[model samples]
Target: MRFIYRLVFALSLTLGVSAQSFAQGLIRDAEAEIMMERYADPLIQAAGLNPDSVDLYLIGDMEFNAFVTGGQNIFMHTGAIVIADQPIEIKGVLAHEIGHIDGAHLARFGDASRGALATMAMTVGLGLAAALAGEGGAGAAIMASGSQFATLDMLRYTRAQEAAADQAAANYLEATGQSGRGLVATFERFRYQEVMSRQRQMEYFRSHPLSADRIGALRRSVDNSPYVDVTDTPEEVDELRRVQAKIIGFMVPPAQTFNRYPESDTSVPARYARSVAYFKRGDLDHARAELQTLMDEEPENPFFRELEGQMLYESGFIAESIAPYERAVELMPDSPLLRIGLATSLIAAGSTEQLESAKAHLRFALTEEPENSLGWYQLSIAHQALGEQALAELATAERAFSVGNNVEAYQFATRAHESLESGTPAWVRAAELKAVAQPSPDEIREWNRNQRQRQPLAPSRGLR
Candidate 1:
């Protein structure tokens, strides 16, 4: 069944919170991307999907739900990471979402409703207007409204479509040599919670609408499958558990999290979680000790090593922070967050020799993840340190403007103007680019027109 996905915010609860508030922090994005490549990529490939073409996004919400937005993006709430039991469970969830994509569910829905199309158009229109006006809050509100509209549209999907996705997900799981049991297990977890008090039931269940028949169907599929190894290896399972614990440790109260999962050798994740709790509670000494102990136990684990560096950096031990970050980069060279951390610390330490390396690292990261505004900003800073003032200003202006960094953009533009020779071609081009970044009547009109062109046509209804 084709359906539009939507997210309904409690206005009273989120009135003052803008959508930008939901953007994944730099560190968080790095962690998420790593996990996606490690686990999600394989499952997506098994499902006969292109991993590179699919955009995975982290939604800054604590709800245990994930859904597709339009036909292009997969939005996963942070809560899903915290609650999932294993990497396969996450893979399972993503596989199901991919099932929707592979089944052309979004296109089917897009072809079904005019109202949804108009909603999408208006949503994009409002977003462009907000961007032009420098009203990030208003833009977020409109984007949220658009998601809600899509969800409502999806709620109308036929049982057959849902069943088809379920079956396809199971097939993909089998083909990938992963147990389809994770799907059943995930559904069972949500199903068990369905009987809880209204307030206790997560938004995942509210929208997913679990039924006895769904559970029955999953069980039947699992029972009929020939694969026997439904469980992950101890190491793989531990990583999943640790990832969840770390996320929850960061999000939930320290006392409550520790109380739920005490520190133990077998439960290294719980220890890590407690370490984070200590860090958050401002007990830096204890936090440092906890992380140090973990590092001693697992000297080669890149995640723990990275956490140690993070602890040091956050606690203001700038000089002491470089070693662990450097070690982590050696262990996981492709990690952008680790590179960002290393770059930031190098800049703070005023290491002129490392500036070029920092620039190279950030430039590489931008190539892989162009939407990372922070990388671009850091790249600009690196260029500045290298005495490339004009280049630095342009990169900074481009990044700051793309992500609504108006004040920074304006400042960079002014600096670029002063740095260039008065009558040269470079100076004129810099001024023009600066104008493009800044607010102006002509720019606003152009932005509006561009938005309209990008808007999707209304979906046709009554096609079930």
Candidate 2:
């Protein structure tokens, strides 16, 4: 398996200092964003939140999970994407996490806690408590000791918050015209897995604590909803699911995934999945062939196009990769990943003529998603290519800090600072932006506070 350990969790807290100080990997593929936006738009609209304001992250892990830290950022485990049979399931999971943010559960906890130390204590204690709660065979012994911590109450409260988030998810799905069935279905699927293993059962029971009655309640709510017919499914959702599958599946061992769906139509994605396997196995020719076949079948599939372009680029076919990447941008104009690939390929091909076009594409991509670190990075390179050192420095600084490349960020920030004519607004802004590259004590506190804002509300103690 092509595993990526320590995939940094999404931290979006508004601390006295910026979490931007930490390095967060950039997964800014045009195809990934396009997929994310498809599901994100509907969920945000349903929850009455601005789609543009929310940032979605795909964590490189095999665990079937999704969660939001104190920040409002939504995180999806790559495993969650690879394992899901359909795109709606991923949406169901994201919508549920969004429910936690919209419900302000974390904010409520912060308000209830007396201070930062107490909040940290509660956070750590709650994690331990949840883990202990999952120790089914040893539940009695664990709980006996677990109750000693003050956060036990808080832990129970967190479970309640999860339930409330569940209820809110149902409402969001129904309001948005998507079926609450997906949510219920996902829950039931987890519930089944919980039943199969004492460990999983304990984990779900501790964190979720849903009973038959609760599941039935959700079912009833879905059954009674009047807005069942209201939702318009975006074609992008399916495409995103396929893209998710391809990317994630490619990351995993082909045997594990192909074993489950040996001859399914989903095999196309599985083949793409195996292509990654081939690449990892150092069979570049086979990998290229597999991706090429996929591209041939779905010529307009930008994700496949991007992959083909990347394969060609990596295989010393820089010139050959350019056309596919250009076509990829034509297919998804707003994709930063494709633009980055195109720019990188252009630079590799040493085409000064394409430099202007590449810069234009990067700029357009940055405008669409300012936090796209790769776009800014590519923009800097493109600027450097055009003999614009000052602009390159500025773009590089912004790119560095936004995605948590503190060292490079600091270097770029300093370069940008030195390149500027003193006392100009550009210099001042660059300096301010650079400050965020390395988070200080105050920034951490502010980030913690921001994270608390997305937390779900604690369930009433008297309810269960």
Candidate 3:
């Protein structure tokens, strides 16, 4: 449930803008990320794309939507995962998106500037065309009509792209020995929504139009697929359910979570959900009890231990939190978030020995997740406690830079540069930060003008 706002710097580099301008609400759960990566890897590989080349980003939104941007990045909403009836359902969705990528549709659309718009006018607008999702009416209107005017052929283009992707998805699933039933099931649920007004329809329907022909084609593909009757493995099904449970627990009201998974449900996922709900409500005793039950059931489960540590730490039991966090890290050494948790607890312990330990864990964590702002912030705190002022400033600069606070980043970089020995890697990085953090001449002039405009006018013509 704890998420981070990740600005895809690559996007800015490709589109010629500031990454911070697009604070995509990307959830930073290591477990969820790993799960999604596992789900998409086969499809990605089957599409003739390197698994490592694709980045699956989990958007923390309630709407069932998914999008691909910056060529290799997949933005999937949590709601999509939550609503899926089977693992294949989500896979079908992924396969279709990958189809779009394999076709290079976005790049192609960007290339063809003329002549397509006229042909696209006959198709339904699907209002705002789904990918430009926002919370306001103005955003909807602009995306639906104005801002995306040039790409009005976007509808025609996307429909064609959708068909191509569907066929591609079917092929990918068939190649991977996976069922396409989930894909068909997913589309079937939305077929009727096509007639609804755009505002009333799910964003997925708006973005990925489901026509009778398209659905019929998908059905034929599904029926012909060799794996059509195959279902997810038992283990995969269980994991999917657990993931959905955790998502619902974190996303819904605590009371609703309790109602949905009442005390009668003694499953691990049910306990996990209840624990999360209790923690959110600040009923630490009940939360601890639920966690204890889970621990007693699965003594060596790292996620269970991680939740225990999280609960203890959030409840101000920092010292008590360390043991579970350390144990969790020992059990799940590959999880950067677990290491970060242990490091954070160590930092809070505040002893010199603890600070050194914290630094080591944070260094390892940064190796896995260099752009994590919270990890950098905690690392800076540890360094500051150890009197490593230059290192602390550098860490602070990285943290600020990651979150788009360029002014603060510049100040920290400057301080780091002033303190660190020249010619070292740290010093070189500090210099880079300083260079990137500097405002342009035009920006400086505009800032000065704004400051002057805000100054009190002389009382020369005052009524007094």
- The residue-by-residue lDDT of candidate 2 on 373-442, one tens digit each, is 5567677877888898987988877765654445556567778888888899878877877776765556
Best by TM-score, which number? Answer: 3
For model 2, the stretches where C-alpha displacement exceeds 4 angstroms are 1-26, 110-159, 192-206, 227-241, 257-267, 385-387, 404-464
lDDT of each: 0.64, 0.60, 0.72
Evaluated against the true structure, the overall lDDT of model 2 is 0.60
Which runs of model 3 end up more than 4 angstroms from their true locations?
A: 1-5, 8-24, 110-157, 403-411, 432-464
What CA RMSD would candidate 3 show? 8.5
Number of the top lDDT candidate: 3
The TM-scores of all predictions, comma-separated, are: 0.74, 0.70, 0.80
